[model samples]
Target: MYGPGDVRVEEVPDPTIDEPTDAVVRVTYASVCGSDLHPYRSMAPSQNGRRMGHEAVGVVEEVGADVTALTVGDTVIVPFSWSDNTCVYCREGFNTSCVHGGFFDGAPSATQAERLRVPQADGTAVVIPEGTDESLMPSLLTLADVYLTGYHAAYTGGVSPGKTVTVIGDGAVGLLTVLAARQVGAERIILMGRHTDRTDLGREFGADDVVPERGEEGIAKVMELTGGDGSHVVVDAVGHLPAYEQAYGVLRPGGTISRVGVPQYEEAPVGMASLFGKNATLTGGPAAQRRYLEAALPQVLAGQIQPGRVFDRRLGLDDIVEAYRLMDSREALKVLIRP
Candidate 1:
């Protein structure tokens, strides 16, 4: 990304193993994340463009001497963030907070390109079994970030049997959160989104109700659906202040609000009425995707869930600008990039 609204596909040098723990991956699939839109909309211009994209699935082409878990020809899902998995935080299932961890976009090589130089390969990449069907690539790609992110929201929110979940936003993460909630056995799931196309998918993913309204009206609708008590958990997949407001508004007194969206605002009401009075918990951040990748991979491989359905459009690498435009304008829910 050069600056706001200017995304380009420029030729760059191929990557190579740069550290003892690093490996080079030939990207087979990559996608434009919603969070990428933040910098896409407001990032300052740069002399040298920022390396964009973090989600990817690829074949390991070369590995450093220390990379024991991966070898040449191995297919792997590169988590959006890289970490040395043996850190204390990683042992506790918080790979995103690993002492030596960093995000892919922060590295010199990013996943959007045809090749990526992955640091901490053994701990950051999940190796897929050999001979996996090519048709399942899209689903496997979700394990890199999207599906695990949704699961993170549900997991952090303490979503489980007998609880009611209200997912705010119908984007890929929100819809998948509905799926995640259902998988964890939530009794009811309510999706708040105005787009019928997306909400429809939410239902298929297990949302029992769709609240098309927003603000006070949306809150009221959700409250009514939950028998006037509000939901046990509210997953805010939209980072706007309004979405946070709706979360607290429709949350039951002791419920949790899990946010997976990249927040747009820094200040929010955590005051008496918004949170403290209800004793609600606010949690969620960059997903520890590596922690959940192993568990979710089987589900995708078995054809149990089609989280990849969130991708509504596909484009080649050269058309990346158009892909960004499609997603920014909401013309595409998500775009799959073939590089």
Candidate 2:
């Protein structure tokens, strides 16, 4: 994004191998993330002509000499962040926090365009099985960030069989969280959202109930659904003051709140009354896509899970500006961009 609400597509130099461990990918599919809208909505600062996307699935066009796992013509899923996967944090399943890891935005090459230069290729690129169905690309693409993010929310929230899960927000990630909750065996999944179309998808994704209300009303509905005890786990997929409060309010004492939303505010109003008093555990951040891809890829491939259905619109790279506008205006669930 050049600035808030301003995204331009310009021909730029193609990506080439710069590091021995790097690989250049010919991206086949990429998508705009909910967090990408943060900068589009003026919630964050962006540099002029900054490369603008982090999710993509593609074929390796070239691999540096040191690259071992991936090779030319290999179909791969590029995780949102690049990591060496050998650092203490990566080994501990915190790939997003790897010592040498970084996001795609502001990088020399981004997935938004036709090509991407993936650093730490051995650890950052996941090879799909040979002869995998091409139709599964969108679903596999989601593994780069959205699906993993939702899985992180569910995993951190302590979702398990017989546990009630309440997911806040109705965006793509939120809907995916509903799927993640089901995968975790949550007995019930309650999604708080207002959009009819999105809530419908939430149900398809396994939400037991959809609360159109917000704030206290939404909290009361969730409590009622949980027999006045609130949910055993709550996920705030929309990071903001109200969403955070709602997530905290509709949680059972000692239950956890897993937040995957990018925080748009400077300070969260967390305190004793809202947290310590209830022993509400809070845990969530940038998802470690590499850590979760192993478990998720199979589901996508087997057709047991289809998160790609969330893409209600598809556009080419040249139409990315309208892609952003559609998302910003809430006219689309998610846009799949082909390059």
Best by TM-score: 1
After superposing candidate 1, which stretches have Cα over 4 Å from the reference? none
- Superposed model 2: Cα runs more than 4 Å off: 43-47
Position 325, candidate 2: lDDT: 94
Worst window of 10 by summed lDDT in candidate 1: 99-108
Candidate 2 local lDDT, 1-339, one digit each (tens) = 878888989988899899999999999999999999987877355555578899989999999999999979999999889999999999998998999899996687888999999999998999999899889999999999998899999987889998999999999999999999999899999999999999999999999999999999999999888889998899999988899999889989999999999878878756888988888899989997878898899999999999998999999999999999999999999999999
Which lDDT tens digits does candidate 1 get at residues 179-234? 99998899999999999999999999999999999999999999888889999999
Q: Listing every candidate in turn, what is its Cα RMSD in Å to the true structure after a full C-alpha superposition?
A: 0.9, 1.2
CA lDDT, every prediction? 0.92, 0.92
Model 2 scores a C-alpha lDDT of 0.92
Residue 178, candidate 1: alpha-carbon lDDT: 93
Q: Score every model by TM-score.
A: 0.98, 0.98
